[model samples]
Target chain A: MAQRTVLFVLFDQVQSLDVTGPVEVFAGAERHTPGTYRIGTASLDGAPVRTSSGLTVVPDRSLADVPDPDTLVVPGGQGTRSPDPRLTDWLRAHGPHVRRLVSVCTGAALLAGAGLLDGRRATTHWAYCDRLAREYPAVDVDPDPIYVRDGHVATSAGVTSGIDLALALVEEDLGRDTALTIARHLVVFLRRPGNQAQFSAQLAAQTARREPLRELQRWITEHPGADLGVETLAARAGLSPRHFARAFRAETGTTPGRYVDRIRLEHARRLLEDTGDGVEQVSRASGYGTPEGMRRAFVKALGTSPAEYRRRFRPAPAH
Target chain B: MAQRTVLFVLFDQVQSLDVTGPVEVFAGAERHTPGTYRIGTASLDGAPVRTSSGLTVVPDRSLADVPDPDTLVVPGGQGTRSPDPRLTDWLRAHGPHVRRLVSVCTGAALLAGAGLLDGRRATTHWAYCDRLAREYPAVDVDPDPIYVRDGHVATSAGVTSGIDLALALVEEDLGRDTALTIARHLVVFLRRPGNQAQFSAQLAAQTARREPLRELQRWITEHPGADLGVETLAARAGLSPRHFARAFRAETGTTPGRYVDRIRLEHARRLLEDTGDGVEQVSRASGYGTPEGMRRAFVKALGTSPAEYRRRFRPAPAH
Candidate 1:
């Protein structure tokens, strides 16, 4: 088989992993299937490109000198916030010719700016998702998935999800067995399904706004065993339950029930990590009616069981 | 709280992700808890250190200028094969003062070469595990775990596992909740428990050596539905079942039964990825008599069920 050329575009201030993570996966794929992928990097002038972390990358070729690539990778970083028009023009000119076009993190912004992702479902770093959506209304930005692949263009959520996206590409080109092998070699999860949410309950909690709602949130967090139903929370907020639910959802972007559940789960997680309490006791203390109820909540929220969560997150005994 | 200083030792030819993955985790931790971890990079001369992938990182300070760090990170790549004496000397001089000493990939070689890992349980990248063990007999090298923590010293296997090690550090310093939040923001698995082996069934199959055993392995792979018992495999290899089992283990470092099981699981995984087969059909085709048996094997080997594996690895139909 002819070697598939994978050309990674290097630009000023690119996130180091946004380039390296996917590149490593492709390199691993080449190792698994010798002579399958010919990896290279290109820059505007073939000079060293400085990364966001003050790292500099030497590109293999200047954009003008490089041959058409089978796969074109554009990584995101602080650079993507204000991309050089030369780079965007290069992508606009060359992106459609590539068999596959991929963006890691805020690289989606560059692609969208280049008109490559217009009207396409895409994603970027969770923190930047709203900005991406607001900036590029033509692009359907879905922030949940680790990656979003629409047609031949793909976009990953953040830095490390680039590896997941590249693994999926390897799976498409080689096979699942090969992808799984590479994933194992990397010691990452075999595959993080693309649709998995990018934000955690804690992250959601951290985004709480409105003093009344924030105070209610803090109260709920501190008193997980308290009756945190909408009626009680609404009363605490000095509003009717219906009004509080709407106001909470509008301000927090989550329903009252979801907010309470997340708070309870966060409390339960802390109990699991800091204390040696068993599942039933912890569940009850966290306001879950039973161990089964808490287990369901854990699985629904974290895709892990209460026991597994505790096993994974529980603090090790100090020596 | 006094901010903990994490000094990442940048060297020529360092794998870019090996530095960025952990640095990002620490940076995320700082975001979660401001003034918690102060991250910086240092090089022997405090110059721009070129990484293995032709990326160069500008270090924050030289060894002479930087204060004693709470944590010191050494990353590895091509440069580790023959580390510069200047780097090793610096490590030897300063390593003991660091509260936590860490290595990613073959950076363990530098640690071991510096005599920092003498008589210590350590690990490196799987590909370099044997050499690490052979070269440093005093250092007990176990390559299975994603990251191995021995006292204040920690070493992670391969490049990406650096994030896992860093997350473990964050969990230890802050809490599991903080680590999980960082992991979620990064779009990586919440926590890959440290002990997870860095090899998959497909990786094992690819490592097969010796002609007769290789042929038998090929036959087993081709015929996953066939009875791949020791007796059948031995007949094919023209040896007694017991002798064949012993020789197989000697050559492959795994028992015949385990090898067959791995091959079957690999086949099952392929089916899950490629075909829209039900769990029962895939189970039967992969020589697992029942779906329950297949489920058990999948859970044991991959920590996921067939359905979940399919959901993760299966390609989405074209829109």
Candidate 2:
């Protein structure tokens, strides 16, 4: 049998990984299972589309010339931010022909725009779930899935989840060994499963909060470097320290102290990962009074020291 | 400071997610701190490069015309499989000028090909780690990292790891709040720093062994539908059941019965995830005689029932 072809459509400011991550899985699969899949790409017009980063991507086919695609993948970017009626029309027109219609991240918005998700259970990037639900009332949006598959329609959460969706499809088409090989190749578990909640339960607990406390949460987020305290935050929310503490637990699903610790820990992690800052500096910048404090947080939250965490998590610098 | 300019180099067979994932994180930052970043892409020859999925991407500039970028991101693809010497040369010549050099997935191989990984700690797509270590003696390859940053060189493991890397970078360049916003927009945690261990200590023990049982293990992996038992496996290994059980524990860090059950459960999981077979059918395919038995195993190992597991883990069908 001829290899099934998966065609990807790209555009200006499009999220690049939405396409590449899945492409990597498919490309890697050839090593394990010879000649099982073929992948390609295209654009709305024949012109090169600049990525959000100003990288121009030329399409393999124009909208007018796309061949019969076994699977059609559409990735989201700033280009999809404002609904393009023509693009929506094109997707709607092509919706029934493709074996599967897949979108990554906010590409779900584009799918929604096309009316393909109007009456089906679907999900997009989580931040946009409310907007998607608001904009497309006909669609039943699932905010939790990494990717949702309803018959032939599939949509993935955020940028990276596309890889999970793709690997799962590969497993479906091939078999477990082949999929495991690809996962090993990618160095990821075979599939996280869309049903596995996208966000951690703890994170959701923190984010699911009501105001005053919500305002305080925003303040902590906005001022990650500040030495935050319960009293100060409580004052900002116009609640007493004890009342605020109780309210915070009720509203955010965690204590004020733990929430603050989480924010600070997250801040320190960002510095350790992206910057060349020493542990001391990162610690201070994340509201920790000392490197030791930050180290303790790392041990508590991640079960690794800050230095070891940096060694494992930091991206290698170009020589 | 003026907004940092980022140039993503595009090419034929480029992984779509590699380009788009980073693009989304970087672009999403503009929503919180607008006008902080400018991102673009270019091809070596400024011609349209076909992505692995046959999507042709038009680039922003030819290699000759691109601005000296603040950050240079090279994504992995089959194009990097046997890298172009010219491309490697271009990277080597320009690598020094860029503030940071980053690679997603197998794109690290290109950096290694360019000699950028010399004497530096690095990582790539896990599947290619052996080849990377074998081929680049100067590079200290760490396969366990989701992403690694040594000096200004950064490399990520596999597809979605790129998003994690990008988020880290954004947090460094911008701030934690901004990075978190982007992460929230994408609906992913700010960092999943401790997610690198692919197998447990028990699985690692199995991987360390090299004997006739190793081949048997491989065979078991290849044929999950088989019903070979301790007796059958012992006969194949030319041992008595008692001796084989002891040796299996000594060599593989697991009891034979437990190992077989684990393998069976793993196979059953894949079937449940990839196929439409009912729980009973999946159980049978994975050598389990009954659905009830499989459910108990599934729940024990994975914390989800087979039916629920399928609903959650099943791959997106090709639309």
Which predicted model would earn the best lDDT?
Answer: 1
Worst 10 residues of 1 chain A by lDDT: A193-202
Q: Which parts of model 1 are misplaced by more than 4 Å?
A: A1-5, A10-13, A34-50, A58-69, A82-98, A113-116, A193-195, A202-319, B1-5, B9-13, B30-70, B82-97, B174-178, B202-319
lDDT tens readout by residue for model 1, A194-279:
34442443344344567878877778878888888889889989999999988888888888788778778878877887899988
User: Which residue ranges in model 2 land beyond 4 Å of their true spot?
Assistant: A1-14, A21-45, A81-84, A97-99, A110-114, A193-319, B10-13, B65-68, B193-319
TM-score of chain A of each: 0.85, 0.64
Which docking category, incorrect, acceptable, medium or high, applies to candidate 2? incorrect
The per-residue C-alpha lDDT of model 1 at residue A78 equals 84
User: Each model's TM-score?
Assistant: 0.77, 0.62
CAPRI classification of candidate 1: acceptable
Shift in Å, residue B3, candidate 2: 2.8
Number of clashing pairs, model 1? Answer: 2
- Per-candidate DockQ values are 0.36, 0.19
